[model samples]
Target chain A: MQPSSQMLKGILEGAILQIIQQGDIYGYALHEKLAALGFGDIPEGTIYPLLLKLQRNKLIIGVRRPTGNGPDRKYYHLTDEGEKTLTIFQQQWHQLVQAMTNLNQGDESS
Target chain B: MQPSSQMLKGILEGAILQIIQQGDIYGYALHEKLAALGFGDIPEGTIYPLLLKLQRNKLIIGVRRPTGNGPDRKYYHLTDEGEKTLTIFQQQWHQLVQAMTNLNQGDESS
Candidate 1:
């Protein structure tokens, strides 16, 4: 039941934001989190650029900090604007789910 | 809670096929049906081209018939290929929903 990349691309940003909202995380950890959460193996190539785009859009902010083990990790967290956008994204997502659920239920009944 | 155009674009084909599977439908009626089903006002400009593509892909077949009101109406129905594709789409959609549901539930629990 792997979702196609096209289907993934549309929702990835919101999913990423939701993940970031869960906790501040660096890129590699975020990639791992998406997989653990059942999004499949989304490449770092796709995740990095989206992270940058979200930063540029002011939906997230990243800050480099000491990792105690090695190189500084740029941890990301949702900004105020990011929270608002995520709320809207959740609403839109739920609405879509509702419509599809209704349609499928109709199919079952008929 | 209208899903963004970008979001809708990814799922429209699957939804259309699902609708066509329920019964034969013309383009205008399809548009109306989508809105009534809560997809909002999806333009005919968007649907007609996708229908043509689906026909080209052999997923659907459209036939022009005398509507007894005015000009010929091209009603569309799902092909066997379309049915297969719709099944796959449904699986992918459900997988996505499952992933998001887990993510949101995780959010709420924490």
Candidate 2:
């Protein structure tokens, strides 16, 4: 079955929090990572707006960094608040996966 | 390790696309679903802007429906382009999980 957009939002939010917890990163680099991870067709438009939202929520802060080549890039770093949020998101994500796993297991049992 | 914000953006984008692929839904309902799924701390501000972006990209279209008791709410439905994107995303997400899983397995082996 196809996952609903609502379900996708939760998953995405969790994933986003998890990514930010790793290190400071810029938009293009992030997109490249996603593409490298096999999301080659993922739209280039989605990331910036989401980044802005994440920043607005105080979960992340942005800094301008000079690139070796071309223009300065905006890189995002996780704040303390962002770290706390990631912890919560991680716990929730594990619970969700466990619940889904159990449900799938039950389906197999029946 | 904590995920960087850029990484989070990709995960979230894929997740959001997946959710819309499942069914028609609105911002509040999507947020509620996220909360139910364990993202209780997820800010209410991020979703609408993302939704608008998705809509603007033509991946989703909105319809306003009256609630049984209050005001009408805007619901988003995935377009054909959205479904195609989801297929690509799912393929990519599976690849990501497989790669990560393999890496984890390698770590355990070592």
Please give, for residues A36-84, the per-residue lDDT of candidate 1 as tens digits: 7666677888889989999999999999999799998899999999999
Runs with alpha carbons beyond 4 Å of true place in candidate 2: A1-110, B1-8, B107-110
Q: Write the per-residue lDDT of candidate 2 for residues B24-94, one digit (tens) a residue.
A: 77888777655544433345677888788888988889999998999889988888898886666655555
Q: Rate the local accuracy (lDDT) of all candidates.
A: 0.79, 0.60
What's the CA error at residue A45 for candidate 1, in Å?
2.4
DockQ of each: 0.22, 0.09
Pairs of residues at least 3 apart in sequence or in different chains that clash in candidate 1 = none
Q: How many clashing pairs in candidate 1?
A: 0
User: Could you tell me which 10 consecutive residues in candidate 1 chain A have the lowest summed lDDT?
Assistant: A1-10
Q: Provide the lDDT at B41 for model 1.
A: 71
For A33-105, candidate 2 gives per-residue lDDT tens digits of 5544443334557778878888999989999988789999998888889898777765554554443333323
lDDT of 1 by residue, B1-110 (tens): 12223332468888889999988999989888877776667778888998999999999999999979988899999988999988877776776777788798773221
> What is the DockQ score, from 0 to 1, of model 2?
0.09
